[model samples]
Target: MAQGPPPPSTPVELLTNKGIIEEPFVNKFWGPALFGTFTFIGVCVSNWFTRRPVFAGIQKHIILSGTAAVIGKFVDDYRAGYLAERDAVLRHYIELHPADFPPFERKKFADVLEPWVPIR
Candidate 1:
């Protein structure tokens, strides 16, 4: 009897249903859980060496991490708002004065404005 078609040659084509099922769970939960556990252990050990109580060290870690997270969120929001305003202004200007931008420049702006395009 003839054999089935050759197995997938490339890594991308070789993925199985099990791999797909595990990928998201590993990415969304396992990675962060591992990192947080390691960080907590490191902080506790460092505090112990410094002669600080374990609970107090944990409290400090929580407070500092919370403050940092809030500050990071505010910064992210500000950056997003700034980028939106800038893109709007650029698009409006392009619309008002199409002659000012050549086709190449227009393409550049389009790429830059695209949300999926990474900033260099």
Candidate 2:
């Protein structure tokens, strides 16, 4: 049987339909959003202090935008490094202990990681 389109619904349903509700909030924020926000704020403060009087406005905007771009690229590279390193470790451990390691898509987990992981 052919299924009809979903009916108009409440706010939650609307959000779900738009994919906002279904999207993982933490995952979304971790990758680029959080990094970008931190970079923007950091650049703004630094530029505010260091910028010359006449060119301060233009410099501030340029600095913030540039910081975000540079930081975002750094974050991407950092994440790729972490993924490669983590996967290597996991593979090594699994090779040492076959019984403990279950076969699965290790790359999937690696791909979902953020640039910064606290080592403690």
Candidate 3:
């Protein structure tokens, strides 16, 4: 005898895949799918608006994108509490290795980011 495959990522995903969490609906499957689908639709809508008046719809897209990012972030944070935990671990690591990470200098900002910017 042998195993077939690995397990699912999250508890909700696992339950939904196995047909265990079948009641009214499958929250795990629908939640991310709907969120991503709507987010992409929102971008398309913004693009549609943008085509009408050159750069007029740009600001709308920016705001909408920002809103989507914030909402998605909030959902992930609420679900996993990753931010605080990662911050705590990072803080501890920094404390343990103060010499490895140097303090930021305002003068070096341009030097740090200039290469990434396009030439033209």
lDDT of 3 by residue, 40-102 (tens): 567776666767643355666567656765676568557655755665677667667768766
* Order by TM-score, highest first: 1, 2, 3
The estimated TM-scores of all candidates read 0.42, 0.39, 0.29
Instruction: Report the Cα lDDT for residue 87, model 2.
Output: 67
How do the residues 50-114 of candidate 2 rate in per-residue lDDT, one tens digit apiece? 77443357666666666676677677778867976776666566567766644443256568977
In model 1, how large is the Cα lDDT of residue 83?
A: 75
TM-score of 1: 0.42
Better of 1 and 2 by lDDT: 2
Model 3 scores a C-alpha lDDT of: 0.57
Model 3 residue 3 lDDT score = 62
Model 2 C-alpha RMSD to native: 16.2
Answer with 1 or 2, whichever has the higher TM-score: 1
Candidate 1, after superposition: displacement of residue 104 in Å?
Answer: 4.1
Off by over 4 Å in 1: 1-56, 104-120
TM-score of 2: 0.39
> How high is the CA lDDT of each candidate model?
0.56, 0.59, 0.57
Clashing pairs in 2: none
Could you say which candidate leads in TM-score? 1
Local error of candidate 3 at residue 111 (angstroms): 64
